[model samples]
Target: MAKPFRVDIVSPDGLAWSGDAEFVVARTPEGEIGILADHEPVMASLAQGVVSVDAVGGERIRVEVEGGFLQVLSNQVTLITDRAVIEK
Candidate 1:
């Protein structure tokens, strides 16, 4: 099993998600950023798109995110945005 990282998605309105994820894929200005457990430090500007995550239990989750910033360090990923809606 792979390590899990903490992924927090916050919108200016409120907290969107706070949980553990095995992997995450997001659309960034540079293209796409994929994060796994214990990934190296990284910072990228996000674009208007969908942010997807593979849950610890293997289920896939996606959230619509507006333009924002993605910060990756150690085992943490902070997604700061102004708008985000979790897919049901």
Candidate 2:
């Protein structure tokens, strides 16, 4: 099982979601990237698409991002976007 890492999804409006997740899939300008706990640090430009996060308690959270930036470091992931909406 993957260890949980801190993840925060934020938009201009405010913080959309913040929690600990075991896995995260995000679409970057280069391609789709999967993140796990203690992954190598990365900073990338996000593409307009869905960012999927597997929460610690088996809950899956999906957020629609209208392009932004993603930063991963020290078992933490932070996504900043101009606009984002959580998908039900």
Candidate 3:
């Protein structure tokens, strides 16, 4: 089984979601990027689009972010946006 990493999706309102995920896919200014556990540290500008998180189990988390920044380091991913909506 793949190891899970910590992911935090946050907005100016507050933390949209925080949990453990096996992988994450996010849109950046350059393009879409996929991240897994122990991924090399990076910081990039996010694009206005959907961000998807594959949780430890079979669940998936999706959020629409207006625009922000994505930071990954030490098995942790942080998404900071001014606006974000959790998709049901």
At residue 31, what lDDT does model 3 achieve?
A: 96
**CA deviation > 4 Å runs, candidate 1:** none
| Candidate 3 per-residue lDDT over residues 1-88, each given as its tens digit | 7899999999989999999999999999899999999999999999999999999997998999999999999999999998989999
Task: Please report how far candidate 2 places residue 84 from its true position, in Å.
Answer: 1.2
Per-residue lDDT, model 1, residue 66, is: 93
Better of 1 and 2 by lDDT: 2
Task: Tell me how many residue pairs clash in candidate 2.
Answer: 0
Off by over 4 Å in 3: none
lDDT of 1: 0.92
lDDT of 2 by residue, 2-70 (tens): 889999999989999999999999999899999999899999999999999999989999999999999
lDDT of 1 by residue, 41-65 (tens): 9888999999999989998889999
Backbone Cα, N, C clashes tallied per candidate: 0, 0, 0
